[model samples]
Target: MTLSWSDPMFRSIVWQVVIIGGFAAIAWYLVSNTSTNLKARRIATGFEFLGRTAGIPIGEHMIDYEPSINTYGYALFVGVLNTLKVSVVGVVLATLLGTLIGILRLSRNWLISKLTASYVEVLRDIPLLLQLLFWYTVLQGLPAARQSFNPVPGVFLSNRGVKLPALNWEAPHLWALAAFVLGCVATHYVGKRADRIQDATGVRPRVWPVALGLLIAVPVAVWAALGAPWSIEWPVLRGFNFQGGLTVSPEYFALLLGLVIYTSAYVAEIVRSGILSVPHGQIEAGGALGLRQGVILRKIILPQALRVIIPPMTSQYLNLTKNSSLAVAIGYQDMVSIANTTLNQTGQAIEGIFMIGLLYLVISLSISLFMNWYNARVALVER
Candidate 1:
């Protein structure tokens, strides 16, 4: 049968095809133009420069990196690792802190609520870059290693960094870590089994005790079996700086602090709004069932509020990740910073830029996919 314009479906299909074709045409033109322009400039292209020596000094690296010996590709990988370290840690800390602040914002006590409100207001208003700069400056103003502040027996804070006792990781630690992971998997299955039992028997079996055993007891047992070797290397004053311990660099600390504080404020608002979105009647019904206020919020309110909270929370997570690029401002070598350095030295501006964009795109998409999956899990399902 021939389609007619009068048919709504036919018209919709035609319009969608037109829009898609238009976008495709424009994309092709832009690509061709870029290639033509590059050719005219006689600039070298492709990712051949990635193999060349990087010779770029990176202060804080998770992986072993040598500036003079490492290739540009390896340097970029280190930069990616640095970015992931900050972004991942920041996301987790921001979520926990944000959830607490959001809950406190709804407290019955006026003082607590008002204080939390002010916190959200001030942080949301202040510029994150300024906050980062302020934190970095404050860290810089701390006394040098000679007059460092010893907070704990093995903890020292100074202009150089925060020195904490380092653990001499042994093979037993790896076995313990593996046991912990296995415990988590067992706990998940146990929880699922409990849920199925509840659905079938009209009563839920307690999973927490079993989870605790699996998550904690099993790991401890594994460590003990392997002869847990706990060795601590404490920091001691060297000539100009502290040595023989784990050091938290000022740049990383400031960046993490600024991201967590700033993002938590926004997350607080999201949490508050999500909780408030739940109808008062639900709380009343929960209370009528003789449930405590905390239980009511947990069992009834939060489960419902999550539907509203998750979508926006995903955006906050993405923002926190992208904001990590600002690490360059304070001399923290993140992906963008290192990529810029690579571009400058290699003169492969196009390739460097494409790689940077691609990396961020992949990272952002990964976060989005995970959040979306979790959201679906928490979403209300209708019979």
Candidate 2:
């Protein structure tokens, strides 16, 4: 009747059941409490409120939205587009600036390295909100429209906003944009082909020339063939204010600048660390094999360092995107800003906050998923 080793299967099954049951019990308890509290507060939850009219003006809506006609759902969609616009531009600009500064920090020239280090320290030490406030103040303090600073004939800078000539795009502009997209896709495939050819044969294909031809040449050719039916609408300083050009509001500019500079500092550090993580032996070996410095960096270092750089860069991007919520302080009409306004106007605090949280969560999760996929693609394998 003594216990035997052959009875191990029964014990394992009992433990597994106990562990799962415990987790399920905890989950049920939490949900039950949440629902009870919500009911006690007389709060009805779900997505029905999304259909209600959002009688609020969104200053910078990407889509044509009317305060009287559009629903909360449409307002939220506009907010989403604005958030994406800022985030995408910020990510691209930050990456470029950060990579340049990161490389400079490691430069052989002492002046360049020290200058870059100082830049990283100074920018990172300042609070992002303060920087945004400062930029906004500066923009607000500029001269009036009559004395607006015009660097070029059509571009006017003033307290009101930055005004620049815009293209009145006809059908040809759309065709050009389509051609540009196709050119980018073609260049990507061409790059892959070049790499494969280089790997298979000792001869390196001229990837940059081919890429330039596809990206610039093809797009220009298509644009020209379509008659280039676009005209520039110049800004003219009339009696009171500037007119006839696309104006970038001070709120938008300040938010964009602050996000870019603040995030670039963190991105710079990530890039520097990633580059440093590449073993010195690799560089030395490349040099020993008679490869030039530029060739070594482009061909050997970047591919390896990208694996280290991409994850932290992704985090910085997500941080910048979330930080855009601070636009509420400066009246940027971003998602958080619009949602806060809605909450105050409608007194639907729970619904407004839920929508805001959901939007941010979705954006963060999407970025994380993309970064995870990229990381998997570039991760080193060990046999």
Candidate 3:
């Protein structure tokens, strides 16, 4: 067989090969160049340094960490965990706050709508880092533990951080958590079965009763079966600072507040746009069917609007996660901050950067995949 340049298929194949080969060649050259430069500078490459003692002090580690005993790998792993904590909490808080503001934007009251609109506009326009700095500064200015603000019992807010009653987590709590997760899975199947039955019989089976049992009763039963220990460790003021309970460090709180507030503004716009995309007829039809406004918004409008909202919401999530790297600025000791420290101490710049990039790529892809799956679920399907 012979291939001619005149053949379109042959031309397309040749161009694709050429483009791919060029990219491959460039990548190879860059790798070789980095290796050569590193060798010439007597700077070690690869990840051998990860086993070395970190000897770096970290504040507010989730797990037990000591600079003297922990390896660089363990430090980096902890850093990744810190990053995830901020990103996960930030995403949930942002979604709730954003959704509320988004709904208020549609309110009939002029003041409510305008106030929310102003909030969104102001937050969206400002740089996120500046907001973080502002929050951190404000929190730093709070009075000492002795003069801490007590807005509620068992809660203390001060320069040190926000301290609240801490629960004694035990093995029973873990069992209860597992049961709750199982219950959620069961509830999902029940809802799916209910939907199928509704479609087949023109009568929707009740889902809430089953959901209540699965989501609540089962978890409680499991907890009780294991002794259900309940105790709160209260923060007590001692030696100019509060001790005991769980303290939310100022750095962490400020970082969380900044990320949630900033990202929520963008998310609010996405939600508002999604809601507005729904046809007015959809609302009128729900009203015609004697459905209350809350029911209409939840059962009809929001479900349909999710089809529009999820894709953009995923972007906001990624942005919020990535933006958490700015925790370095506020001394939150997140992934990027710790990675930079490792890079400096170990001089494994390339490896440090590569790991950081890889972690974020994994996170972003995970969020995107989940959002895409949900988007498909809610997408209008032809019967």
Candidate 1, residues 310-335, lDDT tens digits: the string is: 99999999999999999999988999
- Pairs of colliding residues, candidate 1: none
RMSD of each: 2.3, 3.1, 2.1
lDDT, ranked from best to worst: 1, 3, 2
Q: What is the number of residue pairs that collide in model 1?
A: 0
lDDT per residue for candidate 3 within 196-221, as digits (tens), equals 99889989988999899999999999
Off by over 4 Å in 1: 1-25, 193-208
> By descending TM-score, how would the candidates be arranged?
3, 1, 2
User: What's the lDDT of the predicted structure labeled candidate 2?
Assistant: 0.87
Candidate number of the best lDDT: 1
lDDT of each: 0.95, 0.87, 0.94
TM-scores of the models, in the order given: 0.92, 0.88, 0.93
In candidate 2, stretches whose alpha carbon ends up further than 4 angstroms from where it belongs are: 1-46, 238-240
User: Candidate 3: which stretches are off by over 4 Å?
Assistant: 189-210, 221-228
Alpha-carbon deviation at 383 in model 3, angstroms: 5.1
Q: Which candidate, 2 or 3, has the higher TM-score?
A: 3
lDDT of 1 at 84: 98
Clash counts for all predictions: 0, 0, 0
